[model samples]
Target: MINPNLALKVLDSPFHHTVIHNFLDLDQASLSLEALAEQEFIPTESDLFSYSASNNLSISDNPDIKSLYDSLCSKAWIRKLESLFDVSLSGNVDMAAYVYMNGDFLLPHDDELDSRLLAYSLHLTPNMTLSDGGSFDFFSSNTEGEAKEIVKQVVPKFNSIVIFKVTPESWHQVSEILSDVQRFSLTGWYHG
Candidate 1:
């Protein structure tokens, strides 16, 4: 249920990233949303992030979402990502469901990790606008290599996906949710 032909726009300036719309079939997406709705979200708070997230969703009992997660970690999807980012992926992933309720936000930081080669988010917040304030942002660096400010903002759109190369310059953050509605997403890192 994947659309391999969807526009994969690459932005290299602020640490490589690709934005993809219509990432999955409508039916599959609905299954994911249903599974997410049944899961218990735990509050996760840290100096770096504050939000409610499900425990590693890969271990979930929901066959639909689990099957979808398995497919995303398959060789086929890895190849698609490789073609888009022009980098190899080891077919390993760490994923979880996130719910950013009102005022919940993740502070700015590079998702640079030795094991992670790419970071991604499959957004499921439908009908969200910029005014909603729960957007995904990628930060650009100043000439001195310091993270300056956000260069791109991807609004929470249902069934869209965003993937970024995990370099030190891959700093990014989730803006605080201003609206009363929860911002939902299934996010993870592709490891190499």
Candidate 2:
């Protein structure tokens, strides 16, 4: 379990701040889950659908995957998010593990779930090169148009967890993965 104070610090950091942690054996987990996804799962439009071209694997219904998701949600990290945002989440909050292969990407867009109030993702691949182009880009905008300046660019790394407010203003996307190796991560949203 993560410390609540630490989670608060992560939330209160500057917009789009990137923090790295290496406590979990996410690389091994990623490999195991990736194999499971490849052999036992079927891809759907909801799983792969993004503003840009990308391949995604949804495992919300899998018992093993759901156990992991439940653990994450019960951690102090999630409790801190609730305390910071003053929101209570409920219902069946699902999760998806995305595997971005070479040339796959997700275009800039806000998560559009009415029940969701926060979004979280944990990178599971090891030694991911920043130049591989799977970095997350965050944006800000006004009534005029897309904001000229980029808020931040977060490099995806193993065991790195990113939690953020989810709204129409929180625009973000995963750039195209340029490497042959798959870029894997667990992604989900908190619902109310």
Candidate 3:
């Protein structure tokens, strides 16, 4: 990790989230991208999302990928997450790399899976801009806890990681990619 001692800002309105910039050093980030690029990605599409994704990174045989996955599952990493989120983590994490090409998108939805306490995305795509159109957008909820309109647009800056607490109101989505550039990132959840 580049910034091992991370300083996080918690936002409570739209949803609880923290964006950590410079999450990994350039060398490590490049290596991670290389490893992930070699892995096969399967086309995945549903009513809510469309993209290509790798299998669970925990099962990867590549040393570089395994090291990264192990680091995330490490005690130090869990401690930092627990401290920052103010929640007890079960030390189990599921991770996979995703590539969203032109026209790819994910609709708004709260990550309320069983035992999922937090969801995260680590951006690895360099030179991605606002014009790229693949941003992590957070949505405000109605009084009934249904997702309404987008309240926050988080550009997926290279080497940045976005973490958010999983709740019924924690609705977010990846805006459609209008550009031809591929939006690549590693995403997953931390179990309670």
Candidate 4:
């Protein structure tokens, strides 16, 4: 695993940015879903969009998931976020899986509530095409608080994970899925 300490400089820099790598172990990570029929976790209507005021998925209170969440939190990657954001993360883990079919998309928006301090997403499916429009986009802002430019686009790959500050400035969204294949991922937020 890469030390998240190296990402501190990037996180604290003035420009908005994102980190991408295939290192997270989702098979071992705990999962909870909104749909019971899906077997595997799947995001609800609210979870699929960024504009939703609240998520509809319920996380497992099970110890295994809690242990996995705790282990990941101890990793250098999460520690780097703690240092960069100047916030200590605490409380229960709220997570859900996202499965997008063709034409599915999440509109651009910032995370809400003081409760959600940080956000992370781990991709699980593979063989996705870049042109399929499922990439995550990070935006830059001007002094006046307007979107200045798209600073980066992180392509979704198997085991690829993205961690970012969840303030109003850390604005991001997912493009529409253009392929027939399903796009699967585990998405969640950490509270301070």
Q: Across residues 2-98, which tens digit of lDDT does each residue of candidate 2 receive?
A: 3223333444322432354643455445543554445333333344343222233344455555556556667454565577666676634556667
Q: Tell me, by lDDT, which candidate is best.
A: 3
Backbone steric clashes in candidate 2, count? 0
> For model 1, what is the error of residue 147's alpha carbon versus the real structure, in angstroms, after optimal superposition?
1.4
List, residue by residue over 1-192, the lDDT tens digit for candidate 3.
445666767767677788888887678888998888898999999999999999989888998888778878889888877987889999889999999999999999998999999999999998999899999999999999999999889899988988999999999999999999899999999999
Q: Candidate 4 deviates by what RMSD?
A: 5.0
Range of the 10 consecutive residues with the lowest summed lDDT in candidate 1: 1-10
TM-score versus the correct structure, for each prediction: 0.94, 0.73, 0.96, 0.71
lDDT for 152 (candidate 4): 73
For all candidates, what are the clash counts? 0, 0, 0, 0
Evaluated against the true structure, the overall lDDT of model 1 is 0.85
- Pairs of colliding residues, candidate 2: none
TM-score of 3: 0.96
Worst 10 residues of 3 by lDDT: 1-10
Candidate 1 lDDT score at position 180: 92
How far does residue 54 in candidate 2 sit from its true spot (Å)?
12
